[model samples]
Target: MLEPAEASPGTQAEQASFQGIRRICGFIAENFREDIDCVDIAVSADIHPKYAMSVFKRSTGMSLGEYVSLMRVSYAQALLMRDDASILQVAMDSGFGSVSAFNKCFRKKAGMTPSEFKREHRAAPPPLHA
Candidate 1:
């Protein structure tokens, strides 16, 4: 499904705030692999964390933490598509601090564990090569 970059705002001020949140989103998407927090996102957008919390929620229909989790999980999904790596490797590549964290987030967002997701989504592996 196509997700929108931003939601419609009710006023000029809200629109401006949401635009700032969009910038935060872009920054997160670009630097998600690095350790990031709401403060960093807020700073990147020239806002305070307290205010960013509200604006990001209003603009994205999700909290900043939720957005970060979603991005990490999404990246993990991409990594899981490949069969060349272990779960720990995928978790690390996807910016999760631990395999347990990756599994928990994957299960929460995908309604299944990472292994289950990979098994269900990945096609059958080719026959063993000689």
Candidate 2:
């Protein structure tokens, strides 16, 4: 996935802002599977916590929390494609704090519950053990 970067070459201040955004995005990509917040993201980008959300939102057109939720939901979607794990397991593995939270976010982003998505789109189920 492309980390948020400068849209076009411009002023030095714009260049520096894009660099900070890149660092923030890189940190998010690496740690989206872990619990993280604006403070952590700001620290990763060496920016102020209060400024992180506004900067990220301005560049990416989305809030940090929204970005994190989308990342988690995207990971859960990939996991749901396999039959080896249940929805709850996938939710936890995707870094959601609880099944309900996972379901809510997944529904918002995916337009369906995890179980429904799995049923509709999962690959062939694994062989059953004797």
Tens-digit lDDT string for candidate 1 (5-83) = 5444445576688689788989999988778899999999998899999888877799988899899989888888887
Top TM-score prediction, candidate number: 2
What value of lDDT does candidate 1 attain over all alpha carbons? 0.84
In terms of lDDT, the best-performing candidate is 2
Candidate 2, residues 1-130, lDDT tens digits: the string is: 3234634455656778889999998999899989999999999999998788988899999999999899899999999998787988999999999999999999999999999999998797579999
Global Cα lDDT for candidate 2:
0.89
- In candidate 1, what residue range of length 10 has the lowest lDDT sum? 1-10
Off by over 4 Å in 2: 1-10, 124-130
The pairs that clash in candidate 1 are none
lDDT scores of the candidates, listed in order: 0.84, 0.89
